[model samples]
Target: MTEAKRIPKRSEMDPKYMWDLTPIFESDDEWEKAFQEVKAYITQCQALQGTLGDSAESLLKGLRLQDQVNMKLLKVYVYAHLKKDEDSTNAKYVAYNDRASSLANDIQNALSFVVPEILSIEEDTITQFLQENEDLTLYRHALDEINRQREHVLSASEESIIARAGEVTSAPSNIFSMINNADMKFPRIKDENGEEQELTHGRYVHFMENNSRRVRQDAFEAMYDTYKKQKNTLAATLNASVKKNIFYSRVRRYPSALEASVQKDNVPSKVYEQLIQAIHEYLPVFHRYVALRKKVLELDEHHMYDIYVPLVQEVNMKYSFEEAKDLVLSSLTPLGEEYRDIVNKGYESGWIDVYENEGKRSGAYSSGTYGTPPYILLNYQDNLDNVYTLTHEMGHSLHSYYSRREQPFVYSNYTIFVAEVASTLNEALLTDHLLKTTEDKKRKMYILNHYLDSFRGTVFRQAMFAEFEKIIHEKVERGEALTPDSLSELYYDLNVKYFGPDMKVDEDIALEWARIPHFYYNFYVYKYATGFSAATALSKQILEQGQPAVDRYLQFLKGGSSKYPIDLLKQAGVDMTSPDPVRQALQVFEQTLDEFEALVLDK
Candidate 1:
């Protein structure tokens, strides 16, 4: 008899497969030492609070000290959090992570006086300071950003109070993370070969994409059924989160939480509204794509579980990690040698945690600060979707790489608004490369299906999620409480509107809101849609226009937060302020859908 499968523990994995966190700190003991030193820096920073507006030199000195403390704080915080994410059930790292989070609040409380004090200085004096101190000129844009928030800047003591409230305000997200990552357990389900396999957050997607309807249905029901059991508790956590956003926005004197969030990116809230409008206009296009999927699969009734399975089942494209890396590198050759070389370096230099292990986080992301390698965490499965996941995350890491290499630490980090563009652009380039290279009809059809699904998930579905966030927050703003039933009902309705009548919006899918980690993020999912739109346009330019386009694109990656996200995209050859990019992306989706229909239907 064969043994049942189980997830391997972190220790069971080979050293080469793990990320080298030693670069951040040689060991946990070293990290603890750094942690103690940062606590001292926080005290020192608190001493310099009221001195920032005294003179240009004082202002520069205060700013530099704050930066110095933040630089160290970032390393300490990231190391602890990454270790915690590696194994959420590990009690040692959990305590370390909690303390690190509190340390972050302490640092924020320490430095909260800096912004209000800078805003108190006279405009003419600040200008003169810049003129007198050349070193102070580096913060020209940063100062301007602060001045723009002058209305929201509170008194020093008031700001400190809010800063210290950070841990309380962030509690909902933290609780959700712990429950989702460590406490939640999914049931075992049978795989395609009829062997019992434990369903996991990492394996859920793999099962959803299985060709067998029985397998897909079983996994879908099992996943959501688990969430359903905790639906009320999950609802309370989400309610607390929405209330948190409302609290901060009101405290900061913004009109709404949505406006407050966009203001940080220096983005107008109208852009967010415009993205939803454009997707609404193109809902028919998405509906048509769904119709085509149904016809191609020859299914009598299409459920949400049926949405993810590839239309071309004849070609189940799977790749080993090494093969996926090579394909991603080759696909990115159009970006010039330097860009490709950095991606190669990231692959070789221990910048990635390659596989999912017991208690590790699910999903993939690129994370780091200025001084560290832009590390990627991937729960890799040997499938084509995971290949796209690899490319997408490397897009982010490459953006981090370029920005850190080129910009000052002050400007090294980009906003969440423009972050998705780099990642989605990589996906587009990979799709383009695959289409051009594949001569076989089935493989090409398969590639088109993947591209179409990427659009549906990123643009249409995320826009749907964006709308849901807006609605839920608006309800909270109006003093309505969100119960499990109401939240599930609202989510179910949105799914129906977005998926169209041809698709069956299953009851199980309504509990999806409980499983999503992004909903806790203040108005963040919308950027995924906008980023997809911008990337579709930018990738077209790079493929069709060549070197000049590549040069412009490279410059955009290195821009960091030096310019507003809108202006950065303008430099990359797409204007996200208008609906043109979103429309252009939909047009590409239409074109792909048309071709896909011709091939599969004709065959």
Candidate 2:
């Protein structure tokens, strides 16, 4: 095996390989100019605050100005954050992002008065305002969305206080990351050849997938033990973060913290409940899969660490970054020529930061503002994983491109409820393409297992996480102690329920929740589960129905925040409020498991 190369500094890379920040702002000096101009707009918004109640004309002027401010603010914030992500250690960009964040808060606080004032107007009068000004129809949906939040909308002062406190409330998440990633260290674990390898977070995934069971066990133990040691501290940070959610929920008159979180996306609590209930219905399939894993791995005693080890360990499938790009393009052809054209642009243009550098942000994400093309951040390694990552982020970029092109700024951004659908849909399409194209038996089995595992991870595991968050938050709400032991105990039981009786529920595995950054994300994991289900259903539609389904899916990509997420998905042909999509998704998982079992029998 060849030695891995160290990541290069940002300055050392070819400019063409990097995302073109010039499209956002030509220079730092220009960025500075826009930053000051946003300040003036913020002040302009403040001037129009009380005047919204004066007349329809006054309200229209206020809203139009507010939209301008929102657009400018998005551009400025995204530009700085993109530069900051390129090199997190760069003090200049760090300061740039920090200042951008503060400016965002300023704008939020300044504009906080407008909504409450608008809501203060009589509904009939507001309707008359809209009737009198035909031009104001553009903001009709926008206003209706805000007016729907009438009960949740606090007083101007109260909202201003909350807006300003946003930075303060988010500190626990920042502190948790600092401690979890930067401060803690895991013990070295002996590799298959008996050489000590230092266990880092990145290496943990590789180690978990190692062929040697001993190596996987050692790495798991070391990683969890490190987390176990800090459980109390981690719990405290997580608890405070939960409290922040509860605090906002209480003040905003929401019935629960989960409600407060999901309601922002206009998603019904029933969607969240349906996900958990639907996954519970599919637990038997998971049990069967686990039983089969125990049999196929041929272990005398199955353990938690054995789960990630490949059932077929001999296949060494790898692809170069260039190859990954080609595969992604071919994989997405079901979406038709126009959609594929946008993807080709993504490939030809510098829409992706395709490789890791010394201080680049970890993992991958698709990000952009209304005025610019979507940009992707990726720590790309040349393999099947990177290919999937490429397609996933490209899904997001294409979604943004269509939305921005089709809608105004106010409706150009989609919420998290629908955001994951595009990315996961891309993965599903890519997986089908790979399966159809590959003829090698070993590669087929590997891809088959990979597809099953992806569903398991995205749908089932995230549902378990959603359940855990619900349990912990309810415990906190009931005034129960959220000690390390209590949190671990609940988490451990969920693991047992999720993975089933075939695999040992290792005691150390209880501390697994301690290190998950998503718990602090407040009911966010459930979206991954729901999104996968929706995507599975939609991908099947696009593949089978061809042109008609492709048209609906493209319309969905362009819908953005114009409607509630549930409504948007319904228009896209997945009714997430019902359990049908989840049912279909789990059925697909079972089918994949059956296929895997047949392959193993042949072997």
For TM-score, the strongest prediction is 1
lDDT of 2 by residue, 218-290 (tens): 9999888888778888988988998898899999999889989999988889988988998999999999998
* Clash pairs (backbone) in predicted model 2: none
lDDT of 1 by residue, 248-332 (tens): 8998999999999999998999989999999999999899888888887888999999998998976859999999999999999
Per-residue lDDT of 20 in model 1: 89
- lDDT of the candidates, in the order given: 0.93, 0.86
List where candidate 2 sits over 4 angstroms from the true fold. Answer: 1-17, 180-200
When summed lDDT is taken over every stretch of 10 residues in candidate 1, the lowest stretch is 1-10
Backbone clash count for every predicted candidate, in the order shown: 0, 0
The collision pairs in model 1 are: none
